[model samples]
Target: MKIKTKSKKVNKAWLHDHVTDPYVRLAQKEGYRARAAYKLKEIDEELHLLKPGQLVVDLGAAPGAWSQYVRRKFAPRDAAGGGAAVGALNGTVIALDLLDFEPIEGVHFIQGDFREEAVLAELQAAVNGRPVDVVISDMAPNLSGIEVSDAARIAHLVELAVEFSQQHLRPDGALVCKVFHGSGYSQLVDLFRSSFRTVKPIKPKASRDKSSETFLVGRGLKQQA
Candidate 1:
């Protein structure tokens, strides 16, 4: 009974916070699928990583708020198309996730586990030989509440994103990946430093104050990696 009561209280607290979150209200007004779009928007505003006509790969892109944000960036800035959804997209977006998402116009969707070789092959095929201008990963493994295990899971996903970036991103392209600040965090930072000419860690205001998540942006891959 105590466990159930505690769980219920936690749920209520989270619900209240979500309802009161300004980002959530703004997302509803802007037609984004989730509040997460603001997080990417803030990061892009800070870094200027996204641009028109770029080919982007989105990893762990379920619920697709980030993709929606990118779509808006690619929206043509003409009288009829400016800031409109499904209007003349000036870029390419390919999104992959373990869970299926509702279709977004002008975005290709793939459903698969990213850790598998076959899925990676399919993702590459979808790229269709174009040099990716940016790769963004928000992938995080399902947490089991074991700190060590969770940290390893997070590190593995980040590492895979790095490897993919090394193989597919343009020499001057960027990779943005979500990583938690805990065990193995420094090692991930070191990995980024070794792989990219520039690395930055960004925590967006849309992210919850208590969340450990931060984004690592790696740009301009170094040779001999």
Candidate 2:
């Protein structure tokens, strides 16, 4: 009885906060599918990582808010960049996720788990030997509340993202990976530092204040061979 009551209170509190979130309201007004778009926007604006005519790979990209943002940036537009919603896109966006979403204009979507070898092969084939300008991964494991196991899953996803970047990203390309602040956080940062010439850790305001999530941006890959 006590547990049920506590759970109800927690749900109510979360709902209230989500309803009043400014980013959520802004996302709806601007035609984004989710509030997550602004998180990537803030990160992109800070680093200037996105540009027209670039080939971008989005991993764990369900719902596709990040891909949408990149699509808009690639579109030739007026000063506000709101002139055209979906027209001729100048860039390539390949998105992969385990869950399916309604198709977006000019985005190639692959539905599969990224951890599987077959899925990885499909994603690589989609690249078609093009120089990937950026590899953005928002992959996250279903949390079980066991810190050790959860941390391992998180680390594994980030490691795979880094490895893919090493193989596919252009020498001057960048990688944006989502990571939580807990066990193994520092190791991920170190991995990024070792692989890229420049590594930055950014915490976007659009991310909830209570969330432990942060982003690691690694640019300009180091020589591997």
Candidate 3:
């Protein structure tokens, strides 16, 4: 009973912090699905990751906030003299997640476990032979509350994301993924270094100050000599 009370207090504290978070309020005012949109937005602004007419794949895109940001960025506008309709962005966004996601404008969603070969094949089919310009993964495994176990699970997902990027991204394509600072972090960084010509680690301002999560942005895939 005492443990339950303590858990409730922790939950309430988290809820309080979330409600008062500036990004959360901003997201609500701007119609974004979640505060995560600001994180992507900050990353995009600094890295110039998204461009018109590019093909992007989003892994672990649930609640559709990341996809929403991509859609808005590429969505054709009259000033650009591009396609004059919603979802008519000069680009395509293919989103995949293990959980079912609500639809987002101008995004193709695949529902399944991304680690499965069948799901990977489906994602490839959705690409329709177009070379991917960028791949973004915000997927994190459900935490087991054990630090070592959690870090291992996170590392596995990061490995899978990197492997998928290697297989599908164009020679000059880029990858951005979420990772935590813990066991296997250095190895994952080494993997990115080997795969990409330039690797950068970024922690967006919207990311919580207390969180150990950071994003790795890799650009210019290296071709085998």
Candidate 4:
């Protein structure tokens, strides 16, 4: 007789859902680390962020898809538009996350908690005293299912990202961060408005319709100075 176990049903259900997930198929075909790449790509298309030979900082950049996009975008090209060798001093992308990620071409990976001062210092040092052109934070707290607590944690992280942007971004740089629409959402938008010349909230097509997550883009950092 075959043995029955409760785990089998759960596993089957998970497999079914994963298999039917459109993003999963799309990611496989496109070679993105996660479906999240589409979200960044959509935002970039709308905002025209990311340029050749610019300094970019990516927070919570594990899996390295975003870094991959950055690398391709800044790949060396000749005046005739031929693919050229990437110079040692070309554009730089620094990816930071608590989880380990395999290194990608043209990306410097730092495995550490972004909340730590040491990690931030190392990232800053990597930039070699030059202000970053763009900062993207995809950081999200582990959900506990407690609405208020989760919102607070998310808000705190957004605040930390804001503070980092204020300190490290160039006057004309930009910041894009993931935020959930929950308690303190409006206040967070207000804070960003005060800090940046323009604040635009974006929801990418790659994002699940049921999700509360949105991306806040702060532009024209020079206004604060």
Ranked by TM-score, the better of candidates 2 and 3 is 2
lDDT of 1 by residue, 185-208 (tens): 999999999999999999999999
What local distance difference test score does each model get? 0.94, 0.93, 0.89, 0.84
**TM-score of each candidate structure, all chains considered together:** 0.98, 0.97, 0.94, 0.87
- For model 4, which pairs clash? 171-222
Q: Which sections of candidate 1 miss by over 4 Å?
A: 79-81
Which should have the higher lDDT, number 1 or number 2? 1
Q: lDDT score, residue 110, model 1?
A: 95
lDDT of 4 by residue, 111-170 (tens): 998888999888878878888899999999899999899889888888999888998898
Query: RMSD, each candidate, Å?
Result: 1.0, 1.4, 2.2, 3.7
Cα error of candidate 3 at position 146, Å: 2.3
How many residue pairs clash in each candidate at the backbone level? Answer: 0, 0, 0, 1
**Could you tell which candidate, 3 or 4, scores higher by lDDT?**
3
Please identify model 2 stretches exceeding 4 Å from their true place. Answer: 78-83
Q: Please, what are the lDDT tens digits per residue for candidate 2 over residues 86-117?
A: 88888899999999998989999999999999
